[model samples]
Target chain A: MGVLMSAIGFGIVTASILAVSSVGFTLQFSVTNVFNLSFGSVMTGTGFIAYALNTSGVSIWASMAIGALCGGVISVALNWLIFGRFIRHGISRFGMVIVTIATGLICDNTIQAFVGPTFYAYNAQPGKAFNLAGMLLTGQELIIIVIAAVMMTATHVGLKSTRLGAAMRGLSVNASLARACGVPTRRVVAVAWFASGVMAGIGSVALFLDTSTFAATTGSQFLIMVIAAAVLGGVGSAEGAVVGALVVGLATEITAAYWNPELKDVVAFVVLILVLLVRPQGMFSQLSSERTAVG
Target chain B: MSAATQLYLATVSVYICVNVIASWALDIQFGVTGVLNFSFVVFQAAGAYTAAILSLGPSSSSGGFQRYVGGWRLPFPVPIIGAMVVGAVLAGVVGLVSLRRLRSDYQAMVMLVVSVIATIVAESQTGLVNGVAGISLVANPMVSLIHATRQTQIWIFVLFCVFCMALVGVVMYATVYSPFGRVLRAVRENDRAIEALGRNANRHRMQAFVIGGALAGLSGALLVEFIGAWAPNGWFYPETFVFFTAVIVGGRGSLTGVAVGAALVGVGVQQAVEYLPITLNPSVIASLEWIITGILTLVFLWTRPQGLLPERRRRFPTPWRSDAPELAERSAATKGDERG
Candidate 1:
């Protein structure tokens, strides 16, 4: 029972953060049709932003917001400046993949240069813990869970009701068709970049809050897990991303708890391979041959 | 030259040659065949580990700097043989599991996962490849035969590398001309059409993957021999991208381009580092180098995706431009040679 409850606690925490980042990741993929490997770099950027603000005497919440805003701004800039130009040039999906990787390397190492070569703590105070069924839990973890739930609900409602959300959904389904229908497709894509950036920022801060430290390579290292969650959940489906996150989080935590911790990461990768092999469309989605075609 | 300076030159020279070969191995696999192959570094790691273990003799019962398997102080040639065999075996296993018909992105992900798994295994299992402590390979095979002078060692190693590169080049050239190479290209160009023609596309892809893996392994063995160290930190997924950058920057599907790319991006960029002032932090300079490489790759993609010398397109001759056939004929012949 103790093991089960602790695992549940781990699952919830993991799922919350995963949902935030994966949703942003999927949103960007859906709208832009770019895999955006550099998304993880932006996550690190936000992490550093929050770290910088906190060091300069800001509350964690305010720092999180600033970091998210920074991410939003950077995302918009990248789309406007770099990726959009490449897309206009008729570069293939493979080319875009390489571009994203190059962009990521640039961002990661630039940060490494500025931050030096060591991990630094964000200096956020750990809050009081509440024991729930023999699991040591923190207030921040609960807050993150709440944030995730709120974000998911708000995102669902926005997509279904708001004009902007409808435009985004239409664009995601068929960009050319949406443009033909006069959905302001370019603006929608830009909004997506902004939104994805915000989520990446908030999610990265939450990660740092949980771990209480930051490093240049933190986002890059954590990105493999994020990619696993996003791809496993279904890249274009926000809801699928959340569900996928929950499953992956639970799987990772349980494996770490019961088996060798050294093998936890390897197990996560194995899960990624298994998911791709078993259900390319995701756990909840209907079988669509298009799902397995490409990213 | 002073003995120490000569030794330094030797080491650096060996480094360049080793990386050039490794980069070529990657270029042929990825650039020519369009395989992402994120696990490229692992093959090199395997070869290094194999060569190191075979040349390290038995593990100490009580204490030792590094612990590994198949400890035997084999002669120089034997270690190279061991490296090639290990690479072939590992490549076969990886190819069997991952070279099936799959989405390119999915294939890339699988390779990445394999790389990560290999790193974790290397780091965690102390009994396996010394568990991040790594094995320090000794350059003792020819110690008795040679005078053991730094200049002699440098020249001999340089000769060894050149000989290996020539051998690899001949083998690769032969492969490019072979029927198998044509089939591989056919599969790469259009697997569905090839399948209609009754060729087993997946099998061809697996064959290419395994052969590429062996090349990578050979390169790795050569590298470890020069450096005398084989560690987990040596092989990272990003290193794969460095080669990708080189191949792309030079030109894909062209041997000249691949070599030029390796020379420019792989060696040229590193050489550029020598010009940087010593006052600035080394890490900062390194970071700037990566950023530059990344930017150049992007700029090349957006503006000149075809590269400095784009893969030449074949054209039929017309009365207006009668010289087209001559150009085409020359290119066709070169392309034929390149395929082999």
Candidate 2:
């Protein structure tokens, strides 16, 4: 019973961390139709930025905000400077994936050079650990859960009630149609990229808040998890990302707890392949993609 | 130039020759056939590992630094042949499962997963190629018989690489011009149409993948023999992209273009690193080089998609359509889809 409880606790925290990135990644993929492999690079960059801010004696909250803003700006810049040109030239989608990957490599290695190849520990005071139903709980982990929930609610509300969010939904479904309808498709795409970037930054911050150290490969390694969550949850659906995150997060943590810890990541990879092989379109893509209009 | 300089040039020539073959094989797969083979390097690694274990004689518990499978003493040429076979068999198996009808993006992702999985398995399973510690192949295959100096051996190696390159070039030339090449090209352009014509498109792709894998394996086998060591660190998925970048930056489907791109990326970049002042820490310098390589790859793809040397279109004399009835109908169907 104690093992089960702790495993469940592990699942929730893992899910919360995954949700932050998966939602952002799904949104970017849906709108741009380009799998921005550089998303991992951006995540790592935001992590470093947060580390720098924290080291300079800023509060954790302030550091997170700064990291998010920097991520957003970087995303916006990449769109304007790099991806925008490729789309304009009518490059093949397959080619674009390679382009993104190479760019990600460049960004990752450049940051590695700057960081001197050593891992950085974001020095934050560890809050006291408490017991909840025989499961040890950290205050930071609990706060991350709150952050994920609040962010999801805000995202849900934004999509349903706001004009910008509605435009985003329209553009994602059919860019040409959205453009024909005078929806300012390019601007919507830029905004979506920025929002996704911010989400990735937040995810990075949350992860480090729990682990206390960051490396160049941190985001890229987590990217596999983010991708798994995004795909399992159903592409382009925020709700699906959260639920998918919970499923994968729990399965991985429990398997690690019960089975060999070294094989935990292998379990996740196996699940991803199985899910993809069984259902390529996604589990939750029930309604039309256009249903985002009413979301 | 001095004798030492001449010797260095000969050694570098061999390096360029081997890499060029590997790069061209990758170009044919990715450039002409449009398969994103992120595991390209691993195929080569497979060849290296196979060749190393087969030739290493026997492993002692303490004297040798690593433990591995297939501790047999074999002749040099035997391992090279074994390397090619290893690549073909592995490629065939991987192609069947991964190349099943799926979205291209999904296919690429699966390939990436395959490479990542292979890396982990290779690193973790100590019995497999001695795990991360790696295995070193005995370098001097003919030192006993040839009785040549180091300088002479280097020249001999250079000639060997040149010979391999010539063989590869001849084969590529034959393939790209043959009837089979035409079918491969047609399938690459449109798989469904070629399949409708009763040609197994997937089979053709599998063949291309296998051939490319074999070539990659050959390159690896040769490289490991020259370097005298094989490590898990030798193969990374990103290294595959470096080859991809070369293919793209050199016009795809053009041999000369691949060669040019190979020189610029494979040799030019490495040479550029050599010229940099040794002011910073050594590791920092190495990291910077990789970052620059990555940035160059991205910039080339974004700004110059056609590459430095664009593919020149060949004009072949059109043969009269003897089977006009089927050809006309098939073309019409494809045109209709595009219109829709």
Question: What is the DockQ score of candidate 1, to 2 decimals?
Answer: 0.54
List the lowest-lDDT window of 10 residues for candidate 1 chain B.
Answer: B331-340
How does residue A251 of candidate 2 score in lDDT? 88
TM-score of chain B of 2: 0.88
The DockQ scores of all candidates, in the order shown, are 0.54, 0.43
TM-scores for the candidates: 0.92, 0.91
| Candidate 1 pairs with clashing backbones | B173-B340, B176-B339, B176-B340, B177-B339, B177-B340
Clashing pairs in 2: none
Once superposed on the true structure, which residue ranges of model 2 sit more than 4 Å away at CA?
A: A285-295, B1-7, B61-64, B137-140, B316-340
lDDT of 2 at B78: 86
**Residues A175-200, model 2: lDDT tens digits:** 77887999987788888899999998
Model 1 chain A poorest ten-residue lDDT run: A286-295
Worst 10 residues of 2 chain B by lDDT: B331-340
Instruction: Report chain B TM per candidate.
Output: 0.87, 0.88
